[model samples]
Target chain A: MKIGVIAYRGGNVRSICSALESLGVELLYTAEWEQLRGCAGLIFPGVGAALPAVQDLQRTCLWEKLPTWDRPFLGVCLGMQLLGKESEEGPAPGLGVFSYAVRPFREAPRVIHMGWNAVSPLMQDPLWYGIESPFYVYFVHGYRADVMDCTIAEAVYGERFSAAVRRENFWGVQFHPEKSGEVGFKVLQNFLSICKSYQP
Target chain B: MLAKRIIPCLDVHEGRVVKGIHFQGLREMGDPLSLGLRYEELGADELVYLDISASVEGRKTFLTAVERIASRLRIPFTVGGGVREVADIRALLEAGADKVSLNTAAILRPLLIEEGAALFGRQCIVLAIDVQKEAPALYRVYSHGGRIATDWEVVLWCKEGINRGAGEILLTAIGQDGTRSGFDVQLIRSITSWAKVPVIASGGAGALHHFLEVFREGGADAALAAGLFHEGVLTPYEVKLYLHQYQIPVRL
Candidate 1:
């Protein structure tokens, strides 16, 4: 099955595309929704600032078109932040696919949690199919999403925050699975499998 | 808890890994891609590639090498060397580098740090400082690959870089570099105390205990080594296992 990775500017498109390609999966990396029609899944991979990222999505018209899509979707790093309603990192509003709000890490010892951290799964999900709880995943962000109802996995820096969240077919993780090494590759592989089994 | 990072630095000159002593003497190691993949297999948390190529043709070759490494290597990697302008930073990032470190460029014109941060976010801009202890408690910043000493003090430059929007600091101690005795714990602690950004302690890593001291005593967010790892003295996995025994919280 082909996966559609949105090609917004300032995103970590090369890294994610390379990772997915290594799995021997077909991909359509584009900004146009027309090219994404036949894909089994869609991925929004981001790096860099939030305001510019959201603005790029809006420029590509994917900002409005993305939330309406029913296919299995995965968001990585800042892409996961964009899945929420709003973020404190910038003035731009998120896609609002989930009701969560992203805020800066006020209580953490350091602002940017840039390293590998253990992920504690809170609920059973296909994303964690083979991955065990307390699994180490790579992260590089200063802001975090709060532990909400849709949080499937939680991790603590200073306070517990949403590590992974799933609502219906939407799956988002604050960590960069593309850069998390072998275990992270497993998470992406699991995501592709989830997309394959998805009916809609 | 956030696990401390173990980064293996690869000095690439004309697409081949080279061993540089205090950023001077160069000796060939192996191919960049293979060595990088090996490190990833050996459980390296991240990788840093410093392109030491001087000629324009060499920089092109380094960029190609970076693309090859980025495609194969799964973990994040930072690329630095001769990054003077915003276009330079863009070229490295577009070539698939996760972060671009600025040393001489940022030191010469601090506006590049602010400009890079504005264009490509603060997270990708790393301020790399090479320091040499001048006095008992005073350290001076070095430029031109630790060859030229500058008047910029360590603590002031670090705070200025952070204020100018550098997200991370890659602090290398010139005196301890290539010596392999141990990291300059005093230098690392001095910057980490005032700087809020993640400080990567580099140079003077001899034994496994040195790594522990940098993390526990120096309060470093990450520790980097080149000659130690390139010489087959210690692997990243072995170091992490050693750190785990000390409750340092490594990703083993």
Candidate 2:
């Protein structure tokens, strides 16, 4: 199956692409919404701040097109933050795919939470698949998504926050599965399988 | 709580992984890709590839080796040695490396740390400090593969590096490197207390107990070793299991 990774100015396109390809999934890196028609799934990988990332998405017209994507869609890190209504990191409006707001960590021992941490699944879902509960995944961010009904997994650094969120066809993970080792790849593998089985 | 990390460091010279005693008398370990994959499969938390000769030869890191290893493994990998500018960091990240470490260049132009962190985020910039004990409890920073010593003290330099936007510090004690004794617990304890960021204690790791001491006594968030891991002296799996038994959180 083919997956389209939305390419932006500051996103980690190469690493995301390499990770997906290693799982035997064909990738199409594009910003044009029309180009995504041939793919069965979509991935939005990101790095950098929210304001500039939203500005780049708007510039490429992907911001307006993201919410309507019918296939299995995954957003990673800043990509996941962009799915919220807004972020404390910047003044830009997020895609609002989920009814949650992204905010910076408060009273955190450290501002930047960088490294491997565990996540506990809140419910059984195909996205988790073979991954064990409280599996270690790589995270590097300052802002976190507030817990909501759509939250699938939660992790605690200074406080409990959303680690992975799912809303129908759209999925978002605050961690970088591309760099989270074998456990991380299991999550990606699950997503790819979901795409392959997706009727649309 | 975040589990303590066990990282296997690969010192590469001319595209071959090498090991040395106290950074002298280098011996070839094996190919970077195979050794890296082996460590990853053995449950290593992360991997570090240091081009030991890059700075000495005045060239960039071996990108080909990085790309090959990065493509094969599905883990967080850091590449260091001869990283001198923002462009170099960008190039390494573009080649699929999760983080790029700065050493000699960061010391020469301190602002490069800020520039790199600003361009690629602080999480992508790692400040690697090679420190030598100048006197009792006094440590000095070394550069260019431990060939040149600087006036900057280890603790103060690490604090400055954190202030300049380094998200993590890779502290290697030159006196203990490859000696297989143990980590410089005093130096690590002092640096960890002052630095708010995570400290990765490198050098002088012989047994699994050494790893435990660095974490428990030295207050290190992570421990790294080259020779012991490369020579099969201790497997990452065995170390993690040992740490888990001691109630020191580690990913099994």
Per-model C-alpha lDDT, please? 0.91, 0.87
Best by DockQ: 1
lDDT of 2 by residue, B126-172 (tens): 99999999899799999988889998999889988999999889999
Candidate 1, fnat value?
0.80
Candidate 1: deviation at residue B139, Å? Answer: 0.8
Prediction 1 TM-score vs. true: 0.97
What is chain B's TM-score across the candidates, in the order shown? 0.97, 0.94
Place model 2 in a CAPRI quality band: medium
Q: Against the true structure, whose TM-score is highest?
A: 1
lDDT of 1 by residue, A86-195 (tens): 99988669999999999999888876888899999999998998886789999989889999999999999989999999989899999999889988999999999988
Q: How does model 1 score on DockQ?
A: 0.82
